[model samples]
Target chain A: MTVKELRETVKSLLTEGKVDLVIGWGKGTMPGTSTPVFIDTAEKADSLIFDSTCRNNLSVYFTKDRRALAKDDKKIGVLVKGCDSRSLVLNITEKQIDREKVTIIGVPCNGVVDMKKVVGKVDGKEILEFTDDSKKVTVKGREFELTFPLDEVISDSCLTCVRRDAVEYDLFIGEAREPGSDENAYAEVEEFEKLDSEERWERMKQEYSACIRCYACRNVCPSCYCNVCFVDQNDPQWIGKSPEITDTMIFHIIRNLHVAGRCVECGACERACPMDIKLLLLNRKVAKEVRDRFGSITGTGLENKPAMADFKEDENQDFIMG
Target chain B: MIRIEKERIDEFIRALMETWSVYAPARDGKNTLFAPVEDPAGIDHGIFNTDKSPKEIFFPHSEVLFEFEGGEIKKVERDARPIAVWGLRGCDARSLRLLDKVFGSAWQKPDNDMFEDPYWKEKYDDSIIFGTACNEPRSTCFCNWFGAGPHDGAGMDVKVVDTGEAFILDPVSEKGKKYIGSLKGWAEATKKDVTKMKAAAKEADKAMGEVFGMDGIQEKMADLFLKPVWNDIGAKCVNCGACAFICSTCHCFDVQDEGKKGKKGKRIRIWDTCMFPIFTMEASGHNPRDMSKDRLRQRFMHKFSYFINNYDEHLCTGCGRCVIVCPVNLDIREVVREVMACEA
Candidate 1:
């Protein structure tokens, strides 16, 4: 299998002293789940596995300070899916980690199954095994076998994925496909646009009301690595700590604005949310606006500057008030 | 004991709603959560447990203590609505007992001068908890280690056993007995129904294997504060607070004053987690637990050691929500086993 071959490659890198650790996905305690694995030795590489369940962006670990890895200044190898590679590209451009200090093992992804959707569809059955071929997902439970078309169980971000090929990589594991068409990328936003301002505000209020302020969305996003988040600041106290409706709304708006031109639409924020708040709507709306106004697509290439970072004198001013 | 027919469950809920604000495990989008429900049909039937624990009913995510205007403080009135929380699992119900110690549930003015969480006491005082027995526990459930089981009743007033066609409701306290006796349309449980409930409870116990023992874990944790096991255990943690928010027993909170235009303001209390970097930040910017390793150590240490010293019981209830919702899959059971294996 391609995953096994990839494991062997990572194992060799560790044994050869090329990389101190290979960050990848490991078998989770439950079926249809995968956890981030940090393998520092060739013997530990056998636990690594890559499949549709490998939804985590392992590049986030590379950006964090590592005492052991930094003690000897050894190179770190990280496994990146299609969407996760974008974070690596952004990190390289931002100089969060030197490109020379990391080895990227890029893997072609066929989209991952959304755990929320699977849990909903399984109808309280203990999923024994889950296999996905991009087009369909087969779930085997105690006494029943069920198959769901990819459109039903696939993550929302995967469905609207425009970039499926690895843009930057040290080695490509599977067959690389060109960036697929995302004609319906903003279909949900378009439908949301049909609503009036009052309707939109009401919808946002209802969604934000359920937020418990766990900050999982911020912690999971690869771009949000501020040492002191605005929400955590006490001097100015920009946002309230309470879960008030208005406070929650402002928190989401400010957080989305912070990552405006940088969000890669990986759906990590929405997936990480315990309340199932449909947070991607806010991120995608900002993404769509940035795309239409500035003609900037984030993480597309390292050479391309961030939309909010670089500005032209002749920037569009049609929406500016007189 | 009273028996409620499967079809008349709604009738019981509707009757309770007339007297109290009834909350039940109901469908919220795709996940089941404890929400206020008017119709009994809205209650989730097949779900094992709510995604969010019923603890939120007593201890809300945010609550206003008082409002201040022009330096004059005005205390907010507590809601007098007596709440009825239905469909709580035994693990979740037991967690309330642990939280009671932290929130000063035993405090009285003459007896103890310690601060009392009136907000929690107000909601939890007149509240009635209906605990449901888990016949088919999830693989993530490990309550057997914390002196709790799938069918163990610790803080619940009533114990409910789902018998496929009907429910055998057994009162666990005087309040439960009084409440069940006052309710109408519920028949008295028979000998056959009692036997079925016992069998179900026995099956639940067997399903939850006692694979990991916590016999000396609390004492071991007390001595392993300076050990290297914490460094290894905290390595992969992303420092996300999902584990704390989902935990049934975690009860740390932060209070803040929110004012607008410098005229009127309100002081509110919200949930906080020890996993955050700023949870222990001093006003002088001196943080003792600045590193993620220290924060991770505090989380595990407080649950196993500090709480034991204060309350004589471990703070953790072993509901396994932390094991399930963790993004990086850091299992508390594994962490405890490592602590137990640590050489003192």
Candidate 2:
């Protein structure tokens, strides 16, 4: 949907009282970035917009209290891209969110550009306008021209996505586009298998040494809505809270494994890593293993139990010594 | 059935040494560790179990999937080495068979979109194992709890029993038989040797064994998952996860990716534990097993119930490595007994 049309639709949804609040995108005071805003009144609904600049996954707030007053009810409306919509579907499959409680405004996307990359290239100029057809964006009247190629600028998640269309939604805004290519993501796993013991460990240590344990990745991820994280528990912390290499390693490992067969490929973890930690590799690795072992994928349908949820009688262990 | 004399084990070692990386119980300073044997001249055969199992020989504490430098990917190349663990206690050896249910039998797919592990393959493939029967197991051992004994031939490539100055070697598989036969220094054992070995195993089993209440331990463990005794028993845990780390069969792990500015990074899989607080912690500060009691429950249930549910076998090897290695004296034996006390 066009940005103008999206705003009117949100305004109508708010005025009709079909929803308690319409969660939409509002332009940041600085120009390009879109901050998630709850339009409770007609006046606030005018600020809603749909553009390449609206990149944050609004679904994250639905699981927690991002748009709640102490006394107000928390019914929410969200603008979802294809990938974001998949996350919503998976969350529902996981029972993290209820469909009747959410009003989804689906937005078809070729790909949304990463703001961090755009900011680095923008060189301090404020972004003014972004267009879908021209695939060009104007930053403070300076035209930065580009054609649509998802791999270079879009979130890494959209690069190998098999679905470019929203799986489920209440209101449709735009037409679905073709999916991007299936880049051979498993190539590195094969390469890593070649290393000797000492060399393999040395390299793994170097990679984990950069983690700061900020938890930004977890907070922003739509699926990570647990009441208590194991990392912070005191009485019987399965993993320690010291932020040591071992603790960090255990944190990522258990986190990924718990989500194994259920990670919807949101790419939020990768985006939130201030250290640029490739958390998705952990998720993708488990996802790959889950698919290989069980022949099932997540978010495709709500009926499927997560990989670890219910196992088959014949789960493979052929290579093990018997 | 084959037997090599205890005095002639050196010949067997010398023969097997040619084709495989022969690992035996060796002294590292004062603590016993498993390592590759360099000479048949120096070996210590006193211990029934090594302080740590031979898991490190296959699954190391850590391994790299790939490396990243200046935004370009460099995959870690595997070095070729065939592995053969000597003096593998049946409890430790049977654990490998259990490990195969998760790692060996079936993993769903390729690991990552851009990764597949070769390190796991290299160690798992082209490997032969030599396990010894635990004639005189420790009071702490509970291998019988998992349908195995010191002489269980389920997972071992070959079985070894020490009878005074002689060592008996028996193959468990066709490959094992061929490999044992090809080892030139060893002699073909006679029926008399097998009879002597059986008697020795019986004497050892009668004297060294203790009643573990196995039929009750697994069911009791499942029933006692939420018991208060777990808190009293688990409260001593510092959550260092040293128990899981040193465990002969604990197989939980983590994966890492070292990416460049614009390219995909290397993905790695490393060891992990459920005892540490962060082991269940999510990115959003939510932990399902937020209480130590809950994590402790997971540790035992995974060993007794969940693992059995998954593999139709208890995850514990009953080798008691976790019991011995625990720094705070968190004995799994105490926990099991405590679990047995629970009504469920």
Candidate 3:
């Protein structure tokens, strides 16, 4: 849907007093990026936009420290892509956010551009101008101008995303398309599994060694809503604060487990990572396990509990019994 | 005036590596960062700024201050060779100088050596910094706001200008002059080369466009400490350390002792940020900065007001690494403008 329609929808929400604030994407200071904008007044609604550069999952605003934004029983209107909508549903099921307090304005998604991938395509030259159509994305720098197919530069999570439209939404802006095929959904996980244990460990070590331990991935994640993250606890100090490979690995592994089955594969964590670490590989692998063992997909419905949260008599017990 | 051909730059770096532990901007996976360069060919000169600042060279994200076992404490030491950093931008170079006031020298307590950090002094004091001129400053760069520009040579031993074909290295410090005198295969910079460097500097300075008026920002920030604008300014902030971790002048660290079974332990300092709620959390479980806005305000206040009051300058160098890395796009430039325009 056009940004005009999105703004119009939000303006009415604010003017009609349906919501106190609308959380959406606004033009970023830099090219090929969009910032999360909070529109409290109808006039501010004009700042809202929806496009490939709208990478942040706005549902994070409703949780943890940011929960103060929705204080005084102020209702919030959040624009959500397919993955974002799933995160919202998970928040509702986890009882972190009230379903009644939020108006989910779902937008049909074409997938967000990974700026890292774009930079890679340009061989790390600074992109001065960026434009994208439905079919292709173009970037221009001083020395080079390059264009790539939209799919070529979209996030890897978006490539295997089964749902491009929200499963649950208060209002959807455009006609929802059929869910994409799940055939290659776990393709990366399968490839990861192909490696021997030693090779897998080496790969993981190499990837995670680049981590600077900024916790951008955790902070940006919608599912990681713990009031006091384990890493922050000083009494026992679960792990060392250093970015030593062991400590970093522990942090990532624990975070992955904490968000397992709850992560909607929004790619927000990967996008937020300043180090460009492949954070999604382990997350996607856990997601694959959840799907395979529990016969469940997270955030598909308000009624469905997370795979880890739910219990089933017929569920696979190979992990425990083997 | 010394000159090194663009093709022979790697050779010079290799030569420096023989005596000094060289760190330069190098490709680390998809990102470019200041890393130890064993292969000079791996150094990336194309980047306007490294993904992370050169601050980590002296003050690492995590550093072991000392290790202790069986009632004996041992200090951590580095290799005998001093640190040499290549491809530092003018902003980063100035940031190191600003940091030196805190780490290398105890500016607050000039007569005392107790306040000085030995780890920082050991690496930073004797280190040679090769500050490179920005041929094309990025849109986010705002060193000009702090009365610094792309060609600023405040903290450089040698100021380098990349004139497309060759590097015009102007020795700014005695160390740099002596080093250049000792190095071989370096030709004298001609008058044309000097003219080219000056033109490039002018173009880069102009490209920075306009400098924000930061004349009374310190006073403005102090006045606005209790204002409601912080709510609007910090609304989209996720309270992450991305900005602070990437920042060059953000030197706050937390010291922790890690031990295993009460046998052996090491005291280490890890990078910390005011953006995190736990950074201000007290042992009694009471947090002074309980809200995200409070934490967010602390960062800006520390950078703009507190540092300015103490050091007579803003802690920020306007390198724009924080501008690029903030996940939510809480642009510091916009926050600064908003602070300046606030009615407080």
Q: Write candidate 2's Cα lDDT for B120-163 as tens digits.
A: 66677578888888766665577766666656776888887776
Q: Candidate 1 docking category?
A: medium
- The sequence of per-residue lDDT tens digits that candidate 3 reaches over residues B173-238 is 898888888877679999999999999999998889588898889899999999889988988888
**Root mean square deviation (Cα) for candidate 2:** 24.6
lDDT value, residue B6 of candidate 3: 93
Provide the DockQ value for model 1: 0.51
lDDT of 1 by residue, A72-131 (tens): 577888888778888877767776767787888888787877877886797767676887
Q: Give interface RMSD for all predictions.
A: 1.7, 21.6, 0.9
* Per-candidate local distance difference test: 0.81, 0.66, 0.89
**Clash pairs detected, candidate 3:** none
Model 2, position B106: C-alpha lDDT score: 30
* Residue B306 alpha-carbon offset, candidate 2, angstroms: 0.5
Better of 1 and 2 by TM-score: 1
Q: After superposition, how far is residue B200 of candidate 1 from its true place, in Å?
A: 1.5
Reference-based lDDT, residue A2, model 1: 76
